[model samples]
Target: MEQTTKNLVLASIGNIYEQSKSSSLNAGFFESADADLKLVSEYFGVTPNQALIVAMVFALNYKGDTVDIKDLTEFFECNPLKMLEYSDDFETLFNLGIFKKIKSTHRMKLSLANDQFIINQKITEAILLNRAMPVVEKERINDIIELIEELYKLGKQVDDKEMESFELFRHVSSMLDTNAHFPLVKKINEFEFTTTDTYLLLYLIWRTVNGNEATEVGRIAQGIFSSSSARINFVQDIINGDNRLISENLMEVVEAEFFDDTEVKLTANALTLIHEHGIKLFGKKKKSKDLIEPESITVKNLIFNEFEQKQLDFLYSTLSDENFIATQERLEKKGLPKGITVLLHGLPGTGKTETVFQLAKTTGRSILKVDISRSKSMWFGESEKIIKRIFTNYTEYTKNCDRTPILLFNEADAIISKRRDAGTSNTSQTENAMQNIILEELENFKGIFIATTNLSKNLDTAFERRFLFKIEFNKPSLAIKSQIWHDKLPILLQEECDQLASRYDFSGGQIDNIVRKAEIHEIIHGIGVNFDNLLEFCNTELLAKKHESNLGFSKK
Candidate 1:
């Protein structure tokens, strides 16, 4: 006759639990059972004692009750201290996923006895069907985020001293090796960071995507390192930039000058890497007036000179969604930054900002406009954080859009100009710090960035190297200005448009000012002013003269 699970349990845990007051469940008792220790141990591929504990938990789960080592004292009628002997086997079973660990309401400072265990539901079903349990079991990692989060939990255990650093690191390497199917896992494995460094990187990745806002240096050290000296050394390594995560551009320690505080976070490189796996780090997207949708932008006809037009024509073709993605992929393959950074540097009224608007409109993308004024804060270090966040938020916003948007720094002279000498003054230092971070972010930037700056002369050389397309917005040529005038005021005769364009070397933007004044005139007087009135509007548009009163007339 075949031995069923019911008979098996009867021969094992049930026999012991029923009418048996054995103070000691020793080798003699197990050997005397109908299904003895040796028979069960070899069958289950566990030690004799593990077989006994498994049978006990199986029977407990069948009854909808939990089992713990603490409960062993009463169940087996053995001494409570003797019950402690099963902890190693219990944990092994829990780790194997054969037994599920459940939270117990034990008081603090209690030992492993406080950990209650339940048989894995699947394992119990298999047992009921007379099927054998697998020798080893673990949760399968479905994606990079799950793998990172699992390692992160093990890292916290290292802090509790529940596990050693090397063991935690071992699990890190093992988890990565086992889950190398993930894109992020494959990328990280391509590099040879030490196991400890890999774990640290994973911890930061976990924090960033998990939205755990507290990344203070001290707090991180306390959570990741077990001993005081190790914590201090880890903190020092971060501060000194000696840590692999810092040196390799996977993580960063943001410093606050006013309060002398520090917080750690995943760097742009790390953010980009994780994003390649399609995980958008939460809470990084900023919702403010700064984001301009393409649909919201007014269609403006821009007139540039021959040279500027050529540059813009090439840029427009390269930034079309298909061309942009193909180029970025090729650049990434070559280990070059996959960013299409454009520096539109020229005079203030040269249509730099308007060009960005047109580019975004033509490319079918949004514009994350950087408001230069609000980007800086009176409080120290806040500006730098805001700058870093701009990049982070842009990274998140990429996932929210069908095509990545443009990060426009209109009138960016304030941010991209020649950085001041370090430590010159608080404001100067702040400026220098902001520029340095921008340069760094530009290093691995992965999207379209267009900075329109009027400071043609003082723009930093470092910034020059970072920008791929440095197109100058020279003031509109005489012919282009004439065309702009003809387009803006079709009411003007061609000769009159030429005369207006030739007399004043106005840019498209300056021409726009005159067009607005002409609009006001028509609004009040209900008729187009003569050519003299057009010149008058142009003249006062640049001067401080009270130009709105003449109402409909440009000038007499």
Candidate 2:
């Protein structure tokens, strides 16, 4: 067997046995330990002597104290394998001891009165074994040693504070590559790494390592800062890389390439780069960055018609109320309460979702948009767990910050619609279960909750009444549509833009598509505002929408 594999098996056995001894008084403890050991023995199929060696080592070293191998053999009454014959078996264990070794000395002597033989520490024995290995094996041994140490650290019992530290460690470890290549020392400006920035960076590091969504990054920052000034300061630091807040040790592991001899301080550009690339450096598989948050979005850029704007203004004003503020404060001071919900009903292509974003942005709050369609499941009770996880994540995030995060339920009517005629089949049961779960979640939710649905009539009246604000978003007027087109299109396309805007009966999304296509046309054809390209793009969009409408009709 590979030395590392052997050591791992031994360690597992040791841990199980130690756990057994610790809870020996308990009736099930020994039985549980015996079962675990039997499992380990079955897994490794090692000799009895090897099993005993492993068990003895684990028991003695559980507290990270030293143990002499010779003494270990005597204690367990197991014959010691010849150093040369069982070299591979002992290699991994020996190397771990070497890395953990603090001090060692060679001494062969008998106890003065007791006639006991003195020996070196377990760590010393491991080191001696490591040194005896070939040069190639020595490197492999070193790697195993480091791996063991890391696993040991990860398994250590941690308090809340220590947990935070461990999280920081993981974050730093993950960002080592990014930090090394784009070392914060070179990238961050001298003035930026203040106390507030340090805390924010620490929080960012934690979030980064824990695989939290990027949209939650700002919310995490807001939670860490106790005061407005601190929050502002953190934002400033994020907008400017001020100092080396990440650890140097972590930077080394990733072999990060540093800018040579260049005292390049963090500029706005550096901050932008960190925001864009730092997430990638964490080594997670790239997921779609489609999750939308409120503060991160800009309404000025979106195509909001007059009626949509009016509804947005009302919602924004409601969110800005002192009552809302007091409610939020109360939630933070005590804990989250139940029965806070908002319903935004609108037709397709209206600004229900956009308004939700605007409300969150205006209030300087985070938004977690839960897609109800995606939450549906085939298995009984599985959908409930998925829905619960979403709420749990939102709650945990808010609790961490002591701020209420806006929970956005998109297409909520589909999930929480009024019940059909009484039916007890699995599908009906699932639907009923989902509705109950959502209602329960809504009742318990203390923070801002916004539900957007196209078919408002389909929603349960009980659910509808829970919303503090029930707003309807209607289709935009021609005047508002003209403004949306003008705002959405680029400034360089001037007179031609007005003419193009006037022609199309386009929604906000269609207008956005037109602008994107126009940009591409301008870039490829070298024509700044070609009428032909604009018309072509518009026709394509109109045709696509028509095709979708026809498909929906056909399906119906």
Candidate 3:
């Protein structure tokens, strides 16, 4: 937020806008705003015009056509068309159909297509801080309605126009009063905040509600900052310089810019700070999905070889506070990344995934399993955003979590694959970008991260070096396989288990699967656990693997 940095960003944004305006004027009609919008929209997914319009709506308190283009231009130091963009802006928003247009009954001298706009009903509910409401039973709903009615009657009379807004506010107030509010908000509101700080924070919360990580600092200033002429300067003062209201060290917020074209997510620490102050002009934080519970695998009962067991024992010891906390200080002193990143790579069905689960269970850490396929997208540039968002979410999660959870990227080969050859399509570019983000995040990570991949050969060289520990999970040894068989199907004699384990080159997972099939066969057919049936199931499993091209095929 330095003066030089602020001026540079403003200049860059203004240059893009000037080009957009020039193009519009040359054609003698309002044309594509892509050039300007692209610059700002690159950060947020919305078009530049759309971002500007949304900010304006919030600034003008959702006034329809009553919003003044001249005032907006003077306030943000932009052209009138950039402020309004006339009918093109409204039409585009309408086409997106997230907003409803209210026809202006009164004629205006400014231009054509006189209409006002407000967002959808659901959006209004969300904006009003009612979207995070917990579900109640039918009987409780009736009681709540009756209570609201009683409260309404007791309240002072208001005009019909203001009545609806007042009632909604009162209802939200009643709900917060009756129920236990969000713990974070309760704790956050204890700190005092300036009015401008409260508004900016509300805007940040609004963006998150709409699934955006953060809004562009420049656009945010144009939309929300006070002062008509030097609005951008005010934003700089609020964030940077001496007497700044929001700073990284003091508020744990940031206004980051990604030089070298690396993606950056800048959150103004708006939500956290806003939550501290109980200003309700903007909507409350939307309730996120409940954190998925980690699988409860009994680590004590898990089987492993001498080397594997030793590695796991060492892992558990290091993860424990007695060693880890002490060593972390030393690592920081040495200027090395303090995160413990482990790569568990090897053959399919080799217990790589299970090992991660057991490690979490043993260490009393929760596992956030990342499915690589889910993070990918067919759209251009979207995959990279998804990867960046994942890391950002993880950073936030670690900040608030009591014990940092292990981020397990399962079947990670899909993402950590060898960087695509240069000059390929956007898909290849996105894949490389994804790897870049992962690599950078790994370098800076301060929590535990574990990645499992069957195809280690496909992994990028850069990623290999980032992992603190690289453990290969090869197929279980004969003795270990025999132990697995006896453990899973205890009915089998040791001799029989040894014969099966010795004859078949199967992983622990394959052995477990075969045992499960044998158990199901016995249950369905009342055929007591037969060796022939178990062997037959093992043969089918092997054949299925061959059919899937997982095993080597013979060319006759």
Candidate 4:
């Protein structure tokens, strides 16, 4: 804003702009413009050559066209080949965030001619206002999760090829070095890790915090090591547990069958160390494949008969965020269990699971769906441990989340079925053990838990007492079914929908199948949907609708 600063900047730009028309910017060219070069360097804190490059870029057409070295031939009075020599300076300025990299031609290495650049707007503003370079200090991050989030963002930049891999390592290392207010830094400093080990540890922590357990190890090693042989050797060391990251108990491998598919994550000890520093970055993610986000649930405009709808309305009210929190608080005051275990029992395809999803969606909660097959293992005692971990993980999710998620055991016939005598067989013992773990978890559970089962009649007596809400999903009435058909496929006429509803004893799931089939028919055959097409699709929908069984042998 000062006149003196404006005069100095104008003088420097005039000097550089005049020199740019030279026949050539020879070896001693910057030396000749000593006063201008020195002033530019002092203002921007860049090298003389970098300052000259920036000044030249600033003097370009104000429209701010993305210019490559080839495009500067006319202004510099030099050939495109000659301008290529300044690629390193251009690249350096671009990396410093003074120049914006507009795009890349290909994934492979490209010439300076192929690369495009434009002056970063902030840099242009500062220069135009005749102000010194802006020094934006990185905020001192005291939270461990915040630090990991920052690293994760930068790591993504590297993954997207927006940044150099080495820059990510340098930026993170420098950030922690400068902002040493947090205990994480102190703990990391205590490790006394070498640069490579430090980078590996940080990368694993970021990946773990981001719930990216399957990040390729080679891609990370490639980022840490420039030399091809060194990268390969270090990756081998990582996979073989020879690297300091693995040997020091800072990281562990994510089990994968192939070497190329190998990945790594923070070890339990490493997670504990992170926790000791006042923030826990690693917890069970509530938004994953098995854990469904409420928005993604497709059970919209769900229709149920009067009795079922009333039961569902009550359940939804109880699970509503504000209501649930208030109920939990009052229950806690009375020294009662704050958990609400819900039993959604009904016939298959009768909207039991769909109702659960709808409840979660309406209540703005996530569903941590249980995979029963995976819960049971062939190995003795592992089944119980798996069940315990599922509950344990859910507990962590509830603590970290704003609204506690619903732990949904969809189609949970195996879980709700009566347990056999433990003395009969090892399988019986395992079943009893899993049931016992569930009973105990329910006793201590402090969040929303819902399990949908078709075989409610076989319910274990103990779990029956634990359920606070039991909502049965019976087959829809004819009127409700007709409404559901019209709602699901708005293209269907009310009379047609009513006729179809009157004809077939279909559940909501079966109707969904028909809608999907009609869509597919229209797409594949370019046929306009008709009632006959709907009827045909409906007729074929039942391949003798059999009850889904959860009986399968363990993989060898």
lDDT of 2 by residue, 51-168 (tens): 4344555456655645454544445344444222433334333333321221123332211111112212443244334332222112231232233233234323121112233333
Per-residue lDDT of candidate 4, residues 141-256 (tens digit):
76766776677666666556655555656667766776567777788888788766776777777776666644688888665554578668987887777877678876766555
Kindly report the root-mean-square deviation of model 4 from the true structure over all alpha carbons. 10.7
* Cα RMSD to the true fold for all candidates: 8.4, 21.7, 21.0, 10.7
Candidate 3 per-residue lDDT over residues 1-556, each given as its tens digit: 2334333334444554444333423332224434444544442245656655543443344444444444345555555565455456655555454455443445343343244565444543433442331222212323322332333332222211222322333333444344325443344334444434433443455455455554555554444322344445654454444322344322222323332111112343543443344422124222333233344456535677888778878887888766777777789999988899998889998888888777777666767667777677765666776776677667655655556778888888867878987588777777788888899889899988999989998888888889988887778888998998889888889998999999899988888789788778879998777777788888887886568754577566
Evaluation by TM-score, superior candidate among 1 and 4 = 1
RMSD of 2: 21.7
Clashing pairs in 3: 188-276, 189-276
lDDT of each: 0.76, 0.52, 0.59, 0.76
TM-score, candidate 3, is 0.53
Name the runs in model 3 displaced over 4 angstroms: 1-268, 275-295, 298-300, 525-528, 545-556
Q: Which portions of model 1 show Cα errors greater than 4 Å?
A: 1-5, 19-22, 26-43, 95-97, 107-111, 126-136, 142-144, 153-198, 207-244, 247-249, 257-261, 268-298, 303-350, 363-409, 414-451, 455-556
Which pairs of residues collide in model 4?
none
Which lDDT tens digits does candidate 1 get at residues 1-556? 2547535744655654442345377666655653555555655677877877777777776677888766667777787788778778987777677788754555333356456788777765655666665455766787777777788888676566565554556557767777878877777777788877777777777887766533777766766666679888887787767887878787777764522266778877777787777677743444458878888889998878788889999999999988998998898999888899999998888888888898899888889998878778777787898898888878767866788889988888877888887767888888888988999999989888989888869988888889999988777777888899999988888899888878887777778888888888889999977788987887777574354575686675
